[model samples]
Target: MHRPRFLSGAIAVAAASLLTSACTTGSGSSADGGGAGGAQGGATVRLALTSDVTTFDPIRQQAASDYVVGRLMYETLVGQDDGGAIVPRLAGTWEQTPIGVTFTLKKGVTCSDGKPLTASQVAASLTRYRTISAGAAMTFGPGNTGAGTTITGDDKAGTVSIELAAPWGELLPGLANSTTGVVCSPGLTAGDRLGTGAVAGAGTGPYELVGAERGSAYELKLRKGYDAWPQYAAMPAGRPAGTLRVSVVRNESTLANQLQTGAVDFGAFTGPDAARFGKGGFRVEAAPLIRNFVAFNQREGHPGADPKIRRAVAQAIDANAFNKVFGGTGQVMTSYVDAKAPCVSTDPSLLTKTDPAAAKETLEGVKIKLVGSNAVGQGAGNTYVQEALRAAGADVQLTNADNGTWATQVMGNQGDWDLTVFPMIYGQLARGGVHFIGDEPADGRNFGAVDNKAFLAGYGAATTTVDQKAKCAAWQKAQKALLQAGDVVPLATVNVHYVFREGVSATIPAGAFDPVTLRIAE
Candidate 1:
């Protein structure tokens, strides 16, 4: 099952009332004068993080934190290599026939608890996810409904057959994500602890969960006898050097201070923090993130439903100004698909450019309310948007609304607001756009409530078509429909930056946006 990023309105509300606290006041060391694991045989690696991870269960929470933890605890049947190719992990090899695809399970593998890993265990794990009662089931088709996936196993041949109702060309790449990680059979009956803030599972990875405290920290120990240990050939020493400790230290200054004082070995830094860290002797790395965009609410009668008003809003704001305030940290995206994506459109003619006069003419005499989060950088661009609309002769009011209430207001079309700002972390598969905007019964990610018939039909065609070139055309066409309808405004792609101490090293894998696998120099 695919999991989209989770956003809570309450989070926005909390951010609005957020007080900037002094995170670096105390000494860098813990009260014990050692990191969470204490000094091990060689050295200990303690990663001090800034954000509070919402949950540890991969199936329950789709947060980046969960993916970070999953990278240590579980191994998917297939995974994305550093080069972004779909590579084998737990399953040694796989092949597809007219009937279905068969995955050959790696021999002599076992979970953290020593339970033998088999075709049945893998099948059972998938079956449990398909039958999850609490969260939304992972779907491969329209309406976000499960496509009746059936996993059949052969103990004699040590293989698993995944039978889909129709041919799913993107199946392997999709399975490389945490949404399809193998779970222990016993853990399947225990219920998902995602919302409860607990981490309990027997997985097949190089590390085992030692403990986790909600909103605080999580500890992991190197797993012995792990069959997938060989997969870490690219990592330092081909294994985790020692036990790793990840702490939640949300303040960027505190994280930087800790890194300098040797209290923490690694963390992410951007914006002012990036500049500060670079001047303070820390190693910084930057990477291109999938495109980010602001969605428009297109539910019936919503202001965004008016083509003229939508076009006016889109044309008014200067993306260059938004990038300036955003700190030149990422590139500006013109299309829904990432620049690196196959079959992406590169024609400049299709891109959105600022046109204040055109925007004003389109929005002449229109009055609209703009709502956004008051958190730092959350709604920095909304100000520019408001200014542009006003320049176009539209009466625009800016309001600080709690993020929680923002979606409901948009969905219900109750608030006088005509626009709001939301950001998305696009995945490699490019399925997020289709799932959130094209699928119905409206998912949390699909805050716009866009219901374009042409887009839906195009999305259906893209998913059903097995040909790669044809599928890309269909997907691009679907995106065009949304853009032409003014259902969403393309925004700049935000760059993700990570900062760490000199001795710390990590292999940040591709495909999974989560940054995990940091190790201290041996």
Candidate 2:
């Protein structure tokens, strides 16, 4: 996701320079109609979302929509405020030691099922995630292969202990993620049944899921008898305002039209639609999104296996051109970390810039195939890359892979393609390679299968380092190996834009991706 800036002459010119192709008005008040709620009992706030949510079960779902919906259904041990600081949620307070960290559960909290929330329940949830099948385990850590940490629960004392092999200063922040939301044992057993049809989790949140229809819509009702709502001392408006009715609309055009007609109070917009919204009187906001890049499948023994070929591909493509084509919404990143992250590299020279002559010389006799998803932006980006590589004197072919089969095809080496475009779904972690790239099976997201001892050593040092600067330096060294080796090419960091009505007021914090705060007015 890229930050949204006020449109300037330079930005407008940059956007106009990019290959580009490709709004509405409305007012009414029904849960089904697109207007502000009426001043009556049982009103619902409708939100039209862009992505479809795959699953309500947090442990098994990886989609951003799932995380957003999960926020409505479950409560994490900790949550980030509008300022991006870790604040109390399910857990009131926490303390850490060399061995592990302990969190004290808040008193008198109850799940949707009316069960008393306790540390035992939170520990049980974590244990279940660690022990469950592959899909579930992958949510908590690197992969679903094995559990590297242990969690203990003391119900009576209302405390949970998370033990790690090494010091994990980011443990609290990590736990604050939706994947670690506490769940009652019954809720776990019931699985996504409630998530599919009704509010399931025993959360202390303001709203509860009443009905969900997979890819269609999710209906959330006010949680009656809930007392742990955030205090709004200044405004004194009704908590949560009212029930939230979220609908998944895949078509950006239709979503824009709906928002304009007052069919939906809020909606998400991207690409060309962002500009359209700005011109149409809608408020557009941007958030930090996972960086998208074209990764050379090192596992595939082909031209990509050659460092020169990979470097050639990286040097040939113009990130600025690609971003321009895609509508200059994101930054061309050098490292995996988002610009707002503390671990981001400061040296601008580290980033790859367009160099056609250098690229041509490097790829003199190379022939490569580039694989990418059939998804919209991905396909466009891949085509631009293919053109760049062709211009650099390499024979490249573009091939399509469905999202579900993409990872499998790359891992199985079934295709003859030398490079594949893959989004670093894990964001900053993708660059750190702490859990994805190294000596161990867990060490490499380097799907290209390239392993350098020096890179692995640097990664190990970075993960164990306590000082922020030192850790950044160590990670920088590790990145240098990946960049220098050209195992994967860093492209532009994609920016996601959310469009809301004029009356709505919100801001996306620096590090967070989702735009949940948009629902809250100042």
Candidate 3:
């Protein structure tokens, strides 16, 4: 899924520099959409999309659209504000203890079935997610595959216990992941039927999924009397008047035409597509998306396994060359940690300025293959990387997979490709500090093979350290170690672009829009 930030599952190829415009909203209203519910009775917000949501099942879905749509149907136990602060969601209050963390469910919350949302359901759902979903490994602590982290529901106590392997950081952020949203046992117990069969889209969100035609359109109706959102006050608030119709239109030009003709009110655009928008009808806003990368393979026998070759690849390519691909619209990435994150750093070790001579010397006839999502940016990147490697004296080929297959193909290490332009589909990274570096490769999350004992040790210290400076220093050490290892290279963190009708107002975080807050102009 690099994400709907690029789909967000291993999900996308986006993130660049910013280009802001006039806009305002409690939930991110933009340039006077007649101030939220402007229509007399209500308004149906039409959203045009570039791709169908990869999956609707919170547990199995990893794409950015999945996360965005997931929020519309489900609610996270914790959610981040625009500034990325962790706030409560399904769980009203949470307290940490030496042994584990305890979360208290909010009272009176009900699923779409009108059944009371219970602590038992929440606990069982997490357990079920571990068993059925690939996201169990994405939860930031020792996952289901690892020892130590465990979940227990005490309905009598009216609380859910999230006991960690041992006080791991990112516990809050892990729970906050949209994939970790609470669901009733029926939804979870219903199995594959819940995701694809009749029971698909069942959840406890402010809106209920009414119908969906795969790769065509999705319809969501407001859950009337479901106005009590978990974090309404911190961000924008809105109750759309009518059903929300999400249209899947992969063609950029056709989608632009639709927006112009008023067929849809919103559309998230690619950089080039956005560049074509005139000043009047659409609102173009650019914000930090994600750190993009050309990740290398580090497992024992790959070309990237050779640190010199990895260094060569890193030094050979020019990230700035990609700016032209975005229509000279974004920043070239050079770090793993998002610059917008509170933990931003300027460590020199993470930087990758190209040196053709060094790259050529390192590669000098080495053979490799670069695989990427069939995105324009990835295609350009494949070209640029292939050219650079060829110039640096290596043999490389470019292959593009359907975007749906991209998220998994890069991670599967299926013995076909050697490198990828899109980095990992990441979320809530800073909280846990360095789990991504140490996650087991088999979990599918660990695409780059990193086995630095020093970094792993620093990751352990990061979990327990109370002081901010010590934690940052520990994280810095880990980052440097990974960079020096040559396999894990950092590139530009750029802004992702999305376009809205002149009157639509919405808030975006890391290239993801908060579906609950979307408001339409009359």
TM-scores for every predicted model: 0.81, 0.80, 0.80
For candidate 2, write residues 139-244 as lDDT tens digits: 3334222456788889899888877665544554466566666667766677657345443555544456766677777666655544433211111122133456
lDDT of 3 by residue, 1-522 (tens): 001110113333121111111122223212122123332214555655555677767776644456666777878776665444555566667776434578877667778777777788888888876666655654545433445567888887678887765555556556666777777766876766666622533587766778888887777766645533545333433435356666655566676666667665566555566665557767776655555667777677778777777888889877777555556566554456555554455566466668999778778888898887765465665676778788888888777776666655666555466887764435334532343465544553566665678767766665555355776777677666666776455555444566776666666654456666665444
lDDT of 1 by residue, 69-178 (tens): 66567677776655334455778778754224688877777776777887888888776666662332323332333655678778778888887776555566566766
Scored by lDDT, model 3 comes in at 0.60
Question: In terms of TM-score, how similar is model 2 to the real structure?
Answer: 0.80
**Each prediction's Cα RMSD?**
6.8, 7.5, 6.4
Against the true structure, candidate 1 has what lDDT? 0.57
Per lDDT, the best of the predicted structures is 3
Candidate 3 global TM-score: 0.80
Candidate lDDT values, in order: 0.57, 0.57, 0.60
Candidate 1 structure, TM-score to reference: 0.81
How much is the lDDT of residue 42 in candidate 1? 26
